[model samples]
Target chain A: MLSETDISAISVTIKLALLSTAILIAIGTPLAWWLSQTKFKFKVVFEAIIALPLILPPTVLGFYLLMTLGSNSPLAGFLEYFGGGSIAFTFSGLVVGSVIYSLPFVVQPLQNSFSAVRIESLEVAATLGASNIDRFFTVAVPLARSGFITAAVLGFAHTVGEFGVVLMIGGNIPGETSVLSIAIYDHVEAMEYSQAHLLAGGLLVASFVMLIFVYLFNRHFSLVRSRDW
Target chain B: MIECQLKINLEGFTLDAKFSVPDQGITVIFGPSGSGKTTLLRAIAGLEKGDSGFLKVGDSIWQTDDNFVPTHKRQIGYVFQDAGLFDHLDVSGNLNYVKKRKTGLKKVFIDSIYTLLDIESLLNRRIGQLSGGEKQRVAIARALLTNPKILLLDEPLSALDLKRKNEILPYLDSLHNQLEIPILYVTHSQDETSRLADHIMLIEDGKIIGNGPINEMLTSFEMPLSHSGDAISIFEARVISRDTDFNLMHLEFNGGQFIVPDNALPIDSLVRIRVAARDVSITKKKQSDTSILNIFPAVVEEIVPEGNAQVIVRLTLNGVVLLACLTRKSSASLKLDKGSSVFVQVKSVAILN
Candidate 1:
C-alpha cells in the first residue's frame, strides 16, 4: 500500500539511477581503458582521482558539487544559458552528483577487467587486420563483459542508496528531485514510521537482490568464459 | 619475397637480423628459447617496433624510416604460442569476428577454413570447452578467416602436450601443402622444423647462423649439429615402393636407396630422410649378411674428435655429405681417417617429411 507521492518518488529514483549509471558507463569505459592500458607518468594521480569518491564522505563531495552548480557558477550559468533553467535544484543536478558519486564503482572494475584481458588477444586481433576500434569492441569488450556487468550493477545500486549527496543537492522536491532515500528520510522526520518502513524495506531488498544478482551472474559468466581458454 | 633488415634493442638483448624468405613455402625460424625468433616474427607483423628497420612483404613496404604502418593495416595473421582465442566468443563467433572486418574477402572463405581446420563440429561450443588441440585448431581457423597475405605461426605447437602436438600436426601439414600463402613458422623443436619447414633459418643468440633449404641446412657441418658431437645428414628422397612383407617403405635419393619404417605415403611422394650420425656404422668392407638394410659406398670427408670418448666422421656419399658418430676406440680400431673409402651401414633412419 504505497501512496501516490511514494510512487512518484520511486519513479524519480529509478530515472536518476538509470540516467546516472548510463552516463557513468559511457564516460568511464574509455577513461578506464586508458587507465588500464597507458603507461603515462601521472597514471597514479588519475587513478586516485577516479577512486576519490569511494573514500571521501558523500557530504564533502555534495558540498563541492552544489557550489559548482550554483546559479552564480560558470558551469551553472552555461547550462542556464543553454537550457533556460538553473541545474542547481533540478533532477539534472542530482544526476550529475550521482554520476560522480558512483564513478569509481563503474570505473575501477572496468579498469581491472580491461587490464585482465590478455595482451596476446589484442595483438592477435591486430594481426588479423582489425583496427584499434575494431579490436576494442571485438576482443576487449567481449572479454570484459563480466566486468562491465559488475560495474553497471554496482553503479546502479550505489546510486540508488545515495542519501547525503542527493539530500544536499536535490533539496527534497517531492515529485521531481526527491528520490526514495530522501523520501524515506522525510517520512522518518515526520514520524511516519509505517511509510518509512515500506520505502526502507523496498530499498533494502533491492540493494541486496541487485548485489546478489551481480555476484552470482559474474561468477557464472567468468567461470564459463575462462574455462574455454 | 619477404625481406627484413631490423635492428632493435630489448632489455639485455639486441636483434640485428637480416634475412629474406621466398614468397611461398614455410620458412621456419628454428632456434632455442629466448633466441629472438618470436621477436623477429612480431617485428614482421608490426606488433613490435624496431629502432631502425626496413620491411617489405610481397611488394608493400610496411616499415621504413618515415612510414610505419601499424599492425592493423598490414594483411598479416599471427597465431601465438597460446592460441589467444577470444575466451568470450564461441568457436564460430571467434572465426567470424575477423571475417567480418576483412577487406579482402575474395582470397579465402570462412567455409573453407571450417573444413580445413575440421572445426565445424566446434562452431557452437565456447572456447573454454575446447581441448588444447581444439583451441589451436580454432585459432588457426580464425587466423585463416582473415585471408591474410602471410601467416605467422609463433610457436603455435609449443604450448601443447606431445599427444596434442601429434593431433594437430596433420592440419598444419595440410595447411602447408594446400595453402599457397607463405608461412613464417617459429619453432624451437627440430622435429617440427624438419616436418613442416621447406626452408630453415637457424637462429642463435639473436642472429641467423644458417639459412638455406631444410635438407641442406640440416647437413651443414658448420652449424651446432657438428658441435653436438653427432654427424647429421638430410637426404631428399621420394617414395619409390613399399615393402608390405617387411612393413617398410623404399626411398630413392641421389646418394642411394634407404628403407624407413613408415606408412601412409604413396609412391613418388617427396620426403626427407634423417639418418642420425650415431646410428651409422662405417665399415671398410661390405658385409655379406646383416640386419642393416642400407650399406652405401662413401668417402671419408673429415674426421673430428668430438671429446675424450667420441669421434665425429663426416662422409661424402655420391657427393652428399653425411655424418657418423663413433667411439674413439671404434675409430682407432677401424683406422678411420679422412680421404679413406668406407661402407656406411645405417643402423636406423627416421622419415622426417
Candidate 2:
C-alpha cells in the first residue's frame, strides 16, 4: 500500500544514513583512537565536548549548524567563493548534520574499543619489527573489530531515526532531503494513516533488528574474549 | 660483544646498570621481583627510553647521546611474561604477519620454527583457544619468525605452572643450542637460570652484582647467589658409559665419575648436570658402605653463614668448585671448618641439558 512518494522518501533516508555513517566512521576512527591513547591535559574536556551531541537537543545542534553553514555564514561564503555552493538545505547538509548529531554514537564505541586493546600486544609487535602503521592494522584493528561493528550499526541506526536536526537544516525538501521520518510526519498531518503506519512499522522493525544484531554480536565477542583468556 | 650502559631515573627507583654480554649464548639477568630486570630488557629493545645511555650491539649503536632509534627500527625480538599473542589471529596468521613484512627473508624458515618448537599441530588453532604453555610456545615461534638479531625473553615462563614449565624447558634448550643468536633472558627463578643460562648476570638493586659463566658465578659464594635455594654447581660432562644392569648412567667431569639417574640420552653425548646445595652432604672421612654411590674428595674453601639455622659451605673438589648447604648444628657437630679435607656425598643431581 506504499505510494511512489513514500518509496522515494525511504530510499532517500537509506541513502543519507549510509553516506553519513560511512563519513562518520572514516573521520571518527582516527579521532577516537587519538582520544583513547593520549594522556594530554584537557583530554577529558575534549571528550565531554565531543559527547555533547548525546545530551544536547538535536534541534539546537541543527540550528547552530544551519546558521554556521548557511550562505550568510563565513563557511558558506568561503565555499561559494571556491564555486562549491552553499551547504544548507541540501543532501550534503543532511549528511553533515547527521554526522554531528550522531557523533558520539560512532565515537564512543570506537574509543572504548581502542582503549580495550592490550598495549603489550602493540609493544610486542614493535619488537617484532612491525612498523607503527603495520602494528595498527595487524593488531589494533583486528582486536577492536567488535567495537567497529557496534559503532557502525549504532551510527547507521541513529542516523536513520534522526528527525530534529534533519528537519531544521534540510527543510524537508522532497526527493532531496525529505527522509522517511519527515515523510511519515507529513502523512500523519494530512490524515493519511495507512501510509504513515507502513513507514513507521518499517522503521521500527529495522531499528529493532539492528539493535538485536548489536546485542548478539557483542555477546559473541565477549564469549570469544573470555575463551581466549 | 653487546655492551650497554644506561642510567635512568624513575619516580622512586633509579636504574644504573652497565654490562657487556657475549655475542652468543643466553645471558640471564637473574634478580628478585621489582629489581628492574624487565626494565633493563625493555631498555635494550628500545621500548623504553633511558635518560642517558649507550647501547652497542656489535658496532650498531641503537641509543646514544643524539641518536635514539625507536623499538620498531631495532631488530630485536621481545617475548613478554604473558606471551602477548594477538588473540584475533590464529597461530599461522600470527607467524605469517611478521614473515610477510620481513625485507630480506634470509634466515627465518617457517618449517624450521614449526619443527623446533613443535608447533605444527597448533598452526590452525586460534590464539584464544590455546593453553598457556601453547601460547608461550607460539609467541616464541612468532618472535623467531621476525628474523631478529637478538631475542629478549622477559620471564616468559613466569605465568605457567610447574608442569608447564617442565614441558617448555626442552624447547628453550633447543633454541639455545640451535639458533646461534644472542638471548637476553630475564628471570627471578634460580631453577630456570641454572637450567638454561650459559652466562649469568646477577642483578641486585638495579646493579650487576656478578657476571660470569653460570657455573662459576653460581658456586662462587662471593655474591648473593649463594643464598638462593636452587643455587647449584653446573658441570659439563660427557657420557662415558651406561650401565643397564643397575639403571644408571656414568658421566665424567673435572673431578671424577658420577652416576646420574637419567634416560633417553645416548652414550658419549655431552650434557650439563646441576647438583643442588641441599642435595650434597660433606663428611669428614670417606665412608666404605652406604646406600649412596657417588662420593668425591673435597677441601673446604669457605663457610658462609646463611641464617640462624643454615650455613652454606664452599668446597673445591679437584678443579671444580661446588656449594653445599647444611644446618648450623650439623656443621658444629662435625666440627667443619676451612681447610678441612672432606668427602662430598651427592644425594641427587638434575640433568639440565
Candidate 3:
C-alpha cells in the first residue's frame, strides 16, 4: 500500500523528469553543436566548466544552486519584480536543479555524436545547395538522431534518480518538491522498512528498465548505422 | 568564361593560381601530386577561402575584392575524389536532396541526367551496396541535376581501382559532349588528361606553368607533360572507313589517315584517338613493304634531348603536331635536327570515345 504522499512523490518525480529533460534538450542541442563545430581558442575552458558538474560531488552543485536561487539572489529578485516571488523549495526550483545536475548526461552524447558526423557529408550538402541552417537540420541532425535519443533518455533517467541536489534546493514539501528518491529516504529515516522497500524496489526496477531501453535502442541504432557505411 | 585569380595560404603550402578558361568543353587542370590542382578547384568552387581573389563564371561574379559567394550559391557542381554521397540516403533520396533544395529545375532534365549517367536502375539501392563505379555515376548524376554553370570534378576516378576507373571514364567522356557547361577536371594522371582534355592547364608547385589547347601543351618541349616517360598526343578524328576483314578502322585527322585497330565504331562518327610518343619512330623515307601502316611525311619542328639516352622530336605533319621519342644515338645517326624533313611512323593509335 502507498501513502498519498508517496503517490504525489511519484507524480512529482515524473513531472520533474519530463520538464527537465525537455529544457535540457532545448538548451543542449545548440550548445553541443557549437562545441562540436567551433575552433575558438578558449573552448576548452568552456568545456571544462560544463564538465565540472560531472565529477564534482552532487552536494557541491546543490550548495551553489541553493545560493543562486535563494530568496535574495538576483534571479529571485528579478522574478520578484515580476511578482513571481521566490522559486526556492518549488517545483520550478527542482527542475532547474535537475537540469544542471543532468546536463553532462545530455550534452556529452550530443556533442560526441555531432562530432562524429562526417565533414564530407556536410560539405557535400552545402555544395548541393543546402544553406548552413538547412545543412544542420537535413544532414547533421538526422545523422545524430541516435545521440538525441540517448541524450533524452539519459537526461530523464538521471533527473528521476537525483537526491542530493533536490534535497538541498527543493526541500521536502510532499506534493511540491518531494520526489521518489527523497520519499524513499523519508520512509527509511522513519524506520518504515516495508514502505522503504516498496519505493526503493520500484526505483530499482524503473532504472533497470530505462537502462535496458537505452542499450537495446542503441544496439538497434548501431545496426542501422553499420548498414549506412 | 570562368576566370579566377585565387591565392590561399595553408600551413607549409600556398596555392596561387591565376587563369581564365573558356566556359565550354573540358578544361583539365593537369599537374603532379602536391601541385595545388585540387586546391585550385576548391577555390574555384568557393569551398576554400582565399586571401584575395576574383572569380567570374559566365555572367555571374562569384567573388571580387569586396564580395564573396558561398559554395551553395555559386552554381557549381563539385565531385570529390571519393564520391561524397550521403550514406544516410538511398540513391533516389540523394538525387532528391538536391532537387528539393535547388528548385525550378525540370523533371525532364533530372530524368535525362539519370539516363545520361545510367543510374535510373540504381535509384533505390543503398549507397553502401553500390560498386565504386556505380557510386561515381550516381554522384555525377546528382551534381548534374543541379544544372550548374560549371562542373568541377576533383579526381573523381582516383579513388577507384583500374577496372572501375576504366569503367567510369567513358561516362565522364560523354558528359562533355552531352552537357553544354564547362567542366574543370583535375587529375595527376597523364593518361586521363590525353584521353579527356580539350584544353589543358599545367600547374607545378602552386603556379600555372602554361595553359593552352591540349595538342599544343602536349607537344610543347618545355611542358612537363611532354618530358614524362609516358607522354602522349591526342587527335580529334573522324571514322572515314573500316577494314572489317582485318578488324581495323581508318580515321582521318589533320595529320593524315590512321588505320586504328577498332571494330565497334561506324563510319562518319567523330572520335578522339591517342598516340603515345614512345610508339612513334622517325625515318628519312617511307617504307612500302613493312607491316607498320601509319606513316606520314612531316617536318621536324623542334628537337630536345630528354635524358642522356632519349631525344624527343616535334614534327609538323600537315598542320598537326606529333611527338616522336628517339634514342640520342639514332638522332645523331639520322642527323635529326630542327627544320629537317622526316617521315613520322606511328606504331599504334588508341581510339578514345
Each model's DockQ score: 0.67, 0.64, 0.63
Name the candidate that leads on lDDT.
Answer: 3
How well is each residue in A69-160 modelled by candidate 2, as lDDT tens digits?
A: 88799999899888887799999999999999998999999999999998898998898778899888888988899999999999999999
Q: Estimate each model's TM-score.
A: 0.93, 0.94, 0.97
Model 3 residue runs over 4 Å out of place are: none
Which ranges of candidate 2 are over 4 A from the true structure? B104-108, B228-231, B262-264, B289-291, B327-340
Q: Can you tell me the CAPRI class of model 3?
A: medium
- The residue pairs found clashing in candidate 3 are none
User: Looking at model 3 chain A, which ten-residue stretch has the lowest summed lDDT?
Assistant: A220-229
All candidates in order of lDDT, best leading: 3, 2, 1
* CAPRI-style class, candidate 1: medium
Q: Per-residue lDDT for A1-229 in model 3, tens only?
A: 9999999999999999999999999999999999999999999998888888888898899889889999988988999999887788999999999998999999999999999999889989888999999999999999898899999999999999999999999998989999999999999999999999999999899889988988898898778657733
lDDT, candidate 1, B237-292, per-residue tens: 99999888878888898789888876779999998677888898989899868988
- Residue-level error in angstroms, candidate 1, position B296: 0.9
TM-score, chain A, candidate 1: 0.95
